[model samples]
Target: MLGGKTPSEFMKLPIEERENILRGYLVTDDDVQIEEGDDFGLFNKEIATGSLLQQEYFMGEDEAGKQLVKEARQIYYRENTFSVRSHWLCEFICDTLADGKPIPIESLVQRIIVRVDVEDIYDMDDDMVDFMPEGEKEKSWVVRDLRQLLEFTNAEFIRIEVSGRGALDGSDPQTQEKIKEISGIVKTLIEQFGEKLTIRKLTQLNDGQSIFHDLRSWLMLE
Candidate 1:
């Protein structure tokens, strides 16, 4: 018995059931001891850890869970490990936007694209799942529209664009205040992540004295 059932009883279960139980109980070595000149053992340990992290990420249920697991995987791969931090920033932005109205899924996707460094494409040989169709064979989908990109790439930099279509001028005190609040959030993220993340603001407004301009300047000052 592993948990409650006896070993004999568990062995009698279906293959899938047994597999699930084994996965739940599986534990990989964390502090492997290596003898002198045993470089092969270290290499094997790295490969094993990488595989385990991949499994963890794929088994995750939500974007936040998957992002954390992916961050661990990135650390294992010796790449940047700031994807989870970036995801949190996106979440903060989304929450702020939601304070006014419910953010549409499409709008949320666009916001993520503007704020994250997504791996837009991957080769068939890549060990990723759920790829979109390309021309001939199916390839990894472009990260431009998918929220899952946050889980698959090192999205440490955020670039937000404010359109001049709406009333972004300081004449609208309410709108100006909202922009200031948003700017504050960005500033906080910059201070927290420091060099790990770069935040930028782009605006279509031509007015140098507009709120959008001020927001961009504030970000630059940081």
Candidate 2:
């Protein structure tokens, strides 16, 4: 139109003329309006090559913006699935009695520590145990030689808000009761073996509060 030519012919002009054509397209000599999200209509090859070549026109405004929106959504939900999962393990430990026989002190300690470590895999928050990932092997419990693993879990939970969050607290007091249960196991072991059930390095992170928070942090970091 700017060069006394049709829209198709005008497209044959150089890049500078292409800009002029776009300017003419935007202005309406009479009355014209275009709404967003409406089809732009089939474009001629030359016009498409020249006008649509610009990033904003051809790609639209939302290409990169949509990716960022998706990423934010992903970030928002990254830890939720795991959070729902870690609780089942806690329930299992709390609800199940160890074959009606007392859980050995070292064994009980080992189970609790391993459980705490497992919680770290799903969540980043202080309270919350993440569900295990699909087909992943759970860490072994150090029931036999409970020195290093127990201490490591104990220390890690402490650093990750053991007092604020861990298996030591719950609404039903099951976690605490479990501790006493474990202590009893230790006590019995002490009587049977004629040796002190002294855990010199690792101290349990229970403080009479819900420890889901502690477990969540541990698993999330993991």
Candidate 3:
């Protein structure tokens, strides 16, 4: 710690010197720094450390975006099926393709299975959400991203699978309803965009499905 003297004498220093001193303080204090002051701290070390346990790790937007390209490689580099956790993943893939950022590979990615969570599936609404503050009507990323993503891409047969909640054949009534809703959503995408998008399978979003769909590329010899 810089101790109590920095705070007491902070105003005595030149503005540039003050900035340098503060930056030095931040360099020592910011344990969760991703870049720049995104709500940086002036808290006690022990308190800040404890608070960090309840928080998520921060990623700068540029670093966060690199994940999309990494994921695209996981899909198109060898096999074509890409299971999606968030709807945003599918949207990013479409952009990478449409923007002419081709993924690197030795062979063709003829078929792709882009899986989305059942809870994450929906046609985005245009109206401002009720919870949003007035005059701050930011449109859903889904409208510009996932919904528009399917219209263009490199794959010939892109299967959009809906996973999570419960299976279509499961006994759970609530899960069955979600599956039905997802079926309708997928149907609209197909009807509007033609047969390029299809749903060949429904998998769970839990541990079992995670292993099967995500663990080892469907565990096949292809």
Candidate 4:
């Protein structure tokens, strides 16, 4: 039905409706066809060509326009494999954070929250596993490194809450040491990336408790 319409008619439709139609057409195998003189192929080259032309026209020919079309293609064509998505998100994080501008917490959470994994951040062996039966194959590895967690998750601001009864009272030696280690890692990250990375330690008027929080909560104010 969409293919039968002229470009002007199609452009007259609501943008959301047009997008839905394009998404369906991009992934459906039924759209492909062959003429009497056409060569054999997995999909209809003519349809694919037309789809790309439409995307280019709608998205424009600038760098940002190309990226928009690419992202749309990835979604509509089912070309966004896990690895591809992770890599793109990682690059986006690096570029955005490196720009020295304040980033919206909501955008970070919505875009990168559950989509990324430990493997996407670290260079680990595919077969690495914590445990396996004597004759069984290795399972997937888990995320054990705090640095990888901070970097991959794009958590630049971290809060360490320490409980104590008085100003003189402080955290235990082990907790203090661990906090120092984490602070060192954060400092290294800031040195490498920029001053956008920060960590804060808060002393609460209590004991026997410690908590960590991220700046994601600020999204509420935003």
Candidate 5:
């Protein structure tokens, strides 16, 4: 409520003006709370920089603008939606025929978010699944197993993402030294799967500009 404007209203202003307001909004109050799940929370940087606004055509003001937002929302899922939060959940949604139980992802409101953030111990109970075209039932198999895990289901490009939090925490496998191991996982998935499989660590800080793009330039992804 700084300057008597709601977050939504603040977004409508030009980025030059919006950035000025946000500077005060963020620093003026110690107790100021970020609106989680709101456009403001998810895309603060992109919105403040006008990157996201430019993409959505200033928040879908026209019919043509509406299509951009529509397509963005369809293809762009926030980071936490997939491997960042639930790496294992991805195996269930594979386009390939697997023996696992079916996931009830029928409803638009329903998303299958399974959190498997346990410390990786070398115990017998450890559940290590890989997408490296291995022969483990819990792991992803190439082609005949999870067809789209590698080859494109329909889209021209693919991205598979994971978190470095585990490795950073000095877990059994993801020791602090192995912090870059997650990169290997990303590489393995893309290398083993379709050549187009590319993963980038974009945000929601959640629905930010980098979360969705029209493939204007691959260099922009980095």
Candidate 6:
């Protein structure tokens, strides 16, 4: 058997044993392009090609469908849920943008594209029918535009932080200094956002749960 023996010992064993003990190795050459300077041939080839070509095609279709679903969901949530659609929340977002804060698109998407209390929503509306749009849901043009604007605003904040007069060592700094400056900017943005944006408190008990509870009660009556 290959056992725990070294390479020499494994070699001494039978061919089958040696094969069992063999681990893969990679031999690199000096001419190999291992860095950014290396050639990166580019073409607009579709993703997931080869035998999985169908899967690739399906990916775009599925993505488009998902986007539609998200748009429908946001519209529904905005119309129905006070907890999600409070004036305070909108102001918070506006203030964050105004204060030149940089928030990631992925993070924002995750926050909006979820139903925190689907069960609660259902229980509140006994006659409610959960009907989704046929085919995959696509994102609304409005949401897409808003997201783009936020991303652009974030980029501006990043630029200001890196190149502003307040920046002690602005441009052409060493890698270490650049990293430190960026970290400081991120921290400042976080602090500004926290000061303005307050999370909506959602409790299981309906008693005295903000004005939203009253809204839900009225919705239930209607």
lDDT tens digits, residue span 52-162, model 6 = 111223222355333322332232222221112211223323322112333223222212211122111111122222242445222222222222223322221211111
Sort by lDDT, top down from the best: 3, 4, 1, 5, 2, 6
lDDT for each residue of candidate 1 in 106-200, tens digit (9 for 90 to 100): 11222122322211122245444434345323232222222333332333433443333334332244334334434444555445444543433
- In candidate 3, what residue range of length 10 has the lowest lDDT sum? 213-222
Clashing pairs in model 3? none
Model 6 residue runs over 4 Å out of place are 1-108, 111-175, 193-222
Compare the candidates by lDDT and give the number of the best one. 3
Q: Alpha-carbon error at 140 in model 1, in Å?
A: 35
Give all candidate RMSDs, comma-separated. Answer: 18.2, 23.9, 16.1, 17.0, 14.4, 23.9
For all candidates in order, the CA lDDT equals: 0.35, 0.28, 0.39, 0.37, 0.33, 0.24
Candidate 3: tens digits of C-alpha lDDT, residues 1-222 = 223443334345565664443343222322221112223333323223322211122111243224322332333222323333334444334323313444333133444455555455354465536555776333443332344334444456655554555544333454344445444334555666566765433655546544122211221111
What TM-score would each prediction reach against the true structure? 0.24, 0.16, 0.36, 0.25, 0.26, 0.16
Q: How close to the true structure is residue 47 of candidate 2, measured as C-alpha lDDT?
A: 29
Q: Top model by TM-score, which number?
A: 3
Which runs of model 3 end up more than 4 angstroms from their true locations? 1-81, 94-110, 119-146, 165-171, 179-185, 192-196, 204-222
Residue 96, candidate 5: C-alpha displacement in angstroms: 15
- Estimate, for each residue in 152-174, the C-alpha lDDT of model 5 and write its tens digit: 23333344332233322233343
Q: Model 4: how far is 46 from its true place, Å?
A: 47
Please provide, for model 4 over 1-222, each residue's C-alpha lDDT reduced to its tens digit, 9 standing for 90 to 100.
356665555556776776676665454434223222332323354345434432546545666545445444444334211111222333333322212333322223211221222113233465454344455332222122333335434433322232222222224454343344334444544455454443333344257454333422222122
For candidate 4, what is the TM-score? Answer: 0.25
Clashes of each: 2, 20, 0, 0, 3, 10
Worst 10 residues of 1 by lDDT: 104-113
Between prediction 1 and prediction 5, the one with superior lDDT is 1
